[model samples]
Target: MATIKDIAKQAGVSISTVSYALNGSPKVTPETTERILAIAKELNYIPNAAARSLKTRETKIIGIFLTDFSGAFYGDLLQGTKETLTRKGYELIVCSGKQSHWMLPERMIDGAIILDVTFDSEDLIRYADRGHKLVVLDRELAHPNINQVLLDNKAGATLATEYLIEEGHREIYAVTGPGSSYDSKQRLQAVMQVVERTAGVQLHVIEGDFNKEGGELAAKAIMAGRRDGQAAAAVFCFNDEMAIGMMNYIAEHHSDIQVGEHIHIIGFDNMELASYSQPRLSTIDYSKRKWGALAAEQLVKLINSDAVENERIYVTLLKGKSVGTSK
Candidate 1:
């Protein structure tokens, strides 16, 4: 509600004098600066950030775009991004949906870290052409203004499949994520590759939506295909949520079916709930916090005009009781 003119009128000084004092200009005496600051505090004056940004062309704020805030998977990732940005004198804001996409093109944020599947690569390239800096976690885009921090999905998938193979599961069920998912596609490719090379291995692919419901549906289908109390089979759910869903479904409805005995299972992502299950879920493990931190670090470096190389987060096989030697 208060303006520089009001402060100038109250202080009996010119508008230019008020401006200089408010901005801590050396042209104004320290006594005048202190007096103006005191009046500003009393009047609850807030600086016009929009006008300031126009002059400096920097907001010192970064945005993280997500598809949606769901599940237990995003906690450490977000924490890593926030902590890294905060330590570097930048603030982070999480955004979702198509409406928030304008923040990047409009220069509301200095840079962005993208993990949203809805964001198109063509649109991102257009933004990069306009000199916007970005770090992508979901897909690859080759641009000087854009850098990638992707997971080694191929390696993780291979590890998951190889673990099932090592457990002597010849008839393996592979539950996959959405068709549009880059990670899902990459993992599926790896699974197929491993299945092709391993002797006498067969992979039955089940389409999944990267959710618990998908896993439940896949479990139902698998159960229907097999006879009751038959030999054990190995399943590789593309993500931990689906694996948990399948486990929960079997627990409630098919007590005759035993996990780690009649139906050995493994999943990707190594989500926290993986360990909490009755038979701890074997999964592909990677550092989610490190993934997020690297993305933020790359975005900041890109913003500062520093050369940034695309980075990859490696994966490992985490063995758990949910997987066992098949009969």
Candidate 2:
């Protein structure tokens, strides 16, 4: 029921002054801005997103696009974005691109944080073509207009495998993600690189959906003894979900498989549950939430700013009991 004019009158300021102060225009003095804000708050003023967008060309909303909205894999990542955005006073709008799901046009978003969209180069091209502020995470596509938050997949993958090797594990097995996943290639590449550089060490490889069931099946087949000599001395899973599933299988069926003594397992993504798994899981602890926040932050900067800012973030490893002596 209260209008900007009413607030302006009540604050003893002109309508233009109230408008400039509320919109955060630099022309408004700090003292006047504080007074206007205090009055606005006392009146419980609600900003008109639609009306304000028309004047400033901003909705103050960031779009988060994902392929599928399932599992802790993404949940962990959202954790970072949510916390970071909240602190910065930006709101997030999440949309999934499946089937009839079209991309959220620029009208709904001032900027976007993209993750794991099924469409490849062309979609990214079209996305970039729109000339909207965009930040892509977990995918490798380069463009002058697109800001990417990427990781050293090969390096992180190699670190997990090499850590297992240093722990005296001989035979290592790996479970990869969907073929379309860029991370799948990078992580698997790390495993093979270690295999090629070493002699007499066997690497058992399998592919899965980056889910728990996939890891369980990969574990069963790899441990079934089809490769040279013994079963996998250790398994390095692509994600923590798969690693947890593999551990569950070992607990229910292969009780004799004590981690460290029998077989050690390492996983990537260092999910919240990784440390809680039976013997616990050793994993790469990259901040998915940080990535989310960073992605959102970058997109916002691109949107509000006149220039583009792009950079890559490094992921670190979190040692756990499963890797032996790590906590």
Candidate 3:
């Protein structure tokens, strides 16, 4: 509720003198600076960050935008981003939804790392054209002001599908995330490519929402189709959450169809819960923390006008009891 004007009036000094003293300008004498500080403390004056940023053009704050904050998948990633930003002398703010998009254009944050599909690629490019620095985690944009630090979704999908095929599965199903998701699109493209070229692999595709519920739905569909005498099925759920859901469905309803024996499963994003599932989930593993850290790092470099190339977080196949050879 206090302003520099009030401090200046109380100290019997000009407003400009108060401003200089508060900002530690050498033009103001130490006696005047100390006097102004004492008055400011008495008034409990808090400097306006928005006004300060207007003058300096650097907020020293970075924003990370996500679609939502409900999943375990984002925990390690956000922690990594926060740690890296703090190390770089910047602060991190997590944002979501359309309302928060204004922060980037309004200069509320010095830079942004975008992982939200709700954000239009065109809008991001427009922001880049206007000299806003960005690091994209979910989509591709070819602007000098923007950098890409995306996951190797295609490679992970290929690895998961290939692993299923190697385990001797002929009836393979691929459960995908929302159609709007860039990660889902990339992973599906790779899964389909691998299935198409492989001999005698019957590929079934199911639309999923990258949630546990979506996995449960896919499991229902798989069971409904199994009445046609399909002995064993290998399913590649786009993410571990969905895989866990499907496993839960099978364990609860189809008690006879044991995971790892009758229903081999593989998933992307080796989430923490994947290992603790009834039978450990076989999955494509990548460090979400490292992905987030790289995105934050690249965003800082972009903001500094340093040269940065596009970055990709690689993946590995983690074997688990949930995936076994089809007999």
Candidate 4:
């Protein structure tokens, strides 16, 4: 509740003198600085950050925007981002929804890292035009103030599909994320490309929302379409969350179905639970921490007016019991 005026009055110094001493300016004597600090401590004075930022033009904080905070995917990514930002002498704040849009344009934070699809590319470009530094994880934009740190979605999807084809599976099912997701579109494009070039491969696309419920529905649809004694088919869910949902649905309701044998399953993201599943999930593996850390690093450099190129986090295929040779 205490202010600089109270500290200055108690220390028997002018307000400007208190400001210089508190800011460690050489214009103020060490003796006066010590007196001002003692009085500030006694008064429990908390300096006004907003007022200081107005003068300095830097808040030393960064905002990370997400669509929502529902899934387990954000934990490690956030840790990476937070740790890197802390090491760079900045604070991290997680934000979601339309309300947080004001933080970037209003200069409440030094910069922003964006992964939320709800933000329109034009809006982001407008912000970049206004000199707001940004690092985008979800989509690409060409602007001097904006940098991209995107996943290698196309390559990862290609790897997943090729793995299934190598196992001698001809009928492939691809479950996708929301229509709005750039990652989903990229992965699906790659899947179609692989199917188109590979002779005798039939690709079935299932629309998914990148959630467990969506996965379960996709599984239901896939199973419903199968004949009484059809051969085993391969499925590639765009993310582990949906893949886990599909697995759970099959386990609980379809007693006759088995994962690795009857239905070869693969997913992307290699989420933590993917390894712990009954038949460990075959997935496209990439470092979520590294993705987050790199985004933060680039955003910091962008903020400091350093030259930085766009970045891509690569992926690899992790084989597991969830996938098997075609029957």
Q: What TM-score against the true fold does each predicted structure earn?
A: 0.93, 0.80, 0.92, 0.96
The digit string of per-residue lDDT tens for model 1 on 1-327 reads 998888888888998898888777999999988998898889988877777678779888999999889877899999999989999989999999999999999999999999999999999999999999999999999999999999999999999998888888899999999998999999999999999999899889999988999999999999989986566889999999999999999998899888988899898999998989888989999989999889999999999999889999999999988444644
Higher-TM-score candidate of 2 and 4: 4
The CA lDDT of each predicted structure is: 0.91, 0.76, 0.92, 0.94
Worst 10 residues of 3 by lDDT: 318-327
The top-ranked prediction according to TM-score is 4
Q: What lDDT tens digits, residue by residue, belong to model 3 across residues 293-317?
A: 9999999999888899999999999
Report the C-alpha lDDT of model 2 over 1-327, residue by residue, as the tens digit. Answer: 677998899989899999999989999899999999999998888878778777877777777778787678787577778777777777877777654225345355676777755646676667677776677776766776678888668878988888877776667788888888888888898789998897766787888888889878877875676444344377888888888888887777777667654678888887778767767678887767677777767776666654656666677777777444222
Clashing pairs in 3: none
* lDDT tens digits by residue: candidate 4, 107-177: 99999999999899999999999999999999989999999999999999999999999999999999999
In model 1, what lDDT does residue 93 have? Answer: 94
Candidate 2 lDDT at 99 equals: 42
State the TM-score for model 3.
Answer: 0.92
Candidate 1 global CA lDDT score:
0.91
RMSD of each: 2.1, 4.5, 2.2, 1.5
| Pick by TM-score: 3 or 4, better one | 4
Winner on TM-score between 1 and 3 is 1
Clashes of 4: 0
